[model samples]
Target: MTCIADANVLFSLLVEGHVAHEVARGWWDEQPDGAVGTCLLTRLAVLRLLTNRVAMNGTPVTPTEALGAWGRLGNDPRSVHVEAEPAIHESRFISLVSGRESTPNLWTDAWLAALAMSLDYEITTFDRGFKSFRGLRLRLLSMADK
Candidate 1:
């Protein structure tokens, strides 16, 4: 099945010290080439989180370092970068946000889920919140709650 690396899993995979790093690595290491992909949104999220002081827990990572990590990830044969089809992506995103159960925190998740749904790519994430998105193909990583 085709899958996409969501920000949560990408962040964990790039940060060796993240609580779920090993879990992310285990999932990442086994994927066949072209089986999974990354979109611009998820890659940017990883870059933002990696460089942010708060997200890094006071340990600092420079922009250059974060970019290096980003580069390394793209080098992997298993991960291909995917582009979004703007029209369908925007349409689906709006539909999700206007859904009956929509919540403020769901904006990004909704966008990502909508993008995945538009492209038929399953999202691999640690966040169970994705369950709220109907018809999203997802691989909810197995991990005890932190």
Candidate 2:
């Protein structure tokens, strides 16, 4: 099965000190060639969060460092970078958002869900928020609430 790495899992994989680091790392390492990946949205989110001063608990990473991490991830032979088909992506995103009662914060989450749905990739995430969107195939990572 194809797997899509969500921002949470991507972030955990990048930051060795993260609570989910080991599990994320292990899962990442075990994926067969071409079986795991992440979309541009997830990549952007990882870069933004990793380099943000406030979001990263004041320990902001340098842009260069974040880019290097992204490069390394992309260079992995087993990884695929999924791009969104704009028409399908937008339509699915809107359907997911409008079909449910959701706060404005869920817009990106909806996009992620839509992207995965369109590509038929099962999402890997630690966030339970993804559960709100229907018809998503999720490989929810086992992690303690932090």
Candidate 3:
């Protein structure tokens, strides 16, 4: 199955001490080559989280480390990188947030779901927010810490 790793899953897989590290890594490793995929937005989200000191509880990784980790994921031959197609994403985003008061955080979630749906990929993550996106196919992972 082609699965898109969400920022949360990718972050846990890359950051050793993350609460979901083992669970994410185990699932990630079990995917066959080319079965795991992601889009640019997800990549950037992971990078931002990794380098944001305040967001990461004041223990941010260095820029070099962030880039290195991102590169590793990109370099995986088994991984597929989906294009950042804005039109499709925007259409889905608009449909998703319409008639609802949404914060920027929710917009981000919509963007991720849009990307996955556009590419016909199932999203892998622990975020329950994706449940609101009826168009999204989610492989909901149970967080290790939970």
Candidate 4:
């Protein structure tokens, strides 16, 4: 299936020591060429977390190193870069964030869901919160650490 990864999935896939790395890798490695997708938002979020001192347990990769890892992943034939067609996704993105006082993080979540729903791609992640978005397809992986 064509799938777009959530930030957590991308983060785990990038970090070999991450608890979900093995499972994330196993799943990632099985995808056919052009099946696994990434967007600018999730890719940037993974980079941000990878270089965060506290988030990385005090040994953060430099931005240069972070981009190196990201570039390697991007070089894989199985990985694809995808963009939301703003004309179609914009209204869905709006509907997703409206009618609620959302936390700052939910805006990105809503955008991802809107992207996946609009493009007919399933979101692959460990985050259960994606379930909150109706009509979104999710491949909810259980994190190894938990």
Q: Write down the TM-score of every candidate.
A: 0.91, 0.89, 0.88, 0.93
Residue-level lDDT tens digits of model 1 in 6-120: 8989999888888898899899888998887888888889999999888888885999999999998898888888875556888898988884675765888888888888888
Worst 10 residues of 2 by lDDT: 81-90
* TM-score for predicted model 3 compared with the true structure: 0.88
lDDT of 4 by residue, 1-146 (tens): 88889989888888888888898888887789999889999889999999999878889999999999999998999999995555689899999888968676789999999998889999999998888889999999995534
User: What clash pairs does model 2 have?
Assistant: none
> Which regions of candidate 2 fall more than 4 Å away from where they truly are?
144-146
Evaluated against the true structure, the overall lDDT of model 4 is 0.88
For residues 1-146, write the lDDT of model 2, one tens digit per residue. Answer: 88888888889888888878898888888899898777788889999989988767779899999999989988888788886455687889889888577676588888888888888888889878888778999988876423
Model 4 weakest lDDT span, ten residues long: 79-88
Cα lDDT, model 2, residue 119: 81
Best by TM-score: 4
Candidate ranking (TM-score, best to worst): 4, 1, 2, 3
- In candidate 4, which residue ranges exceed 4 Å CA deviation? 84-86, 144-146
User: Arrange candidates by lDDT, highest first: which order?
Assistant: 4, 1, 2, 3
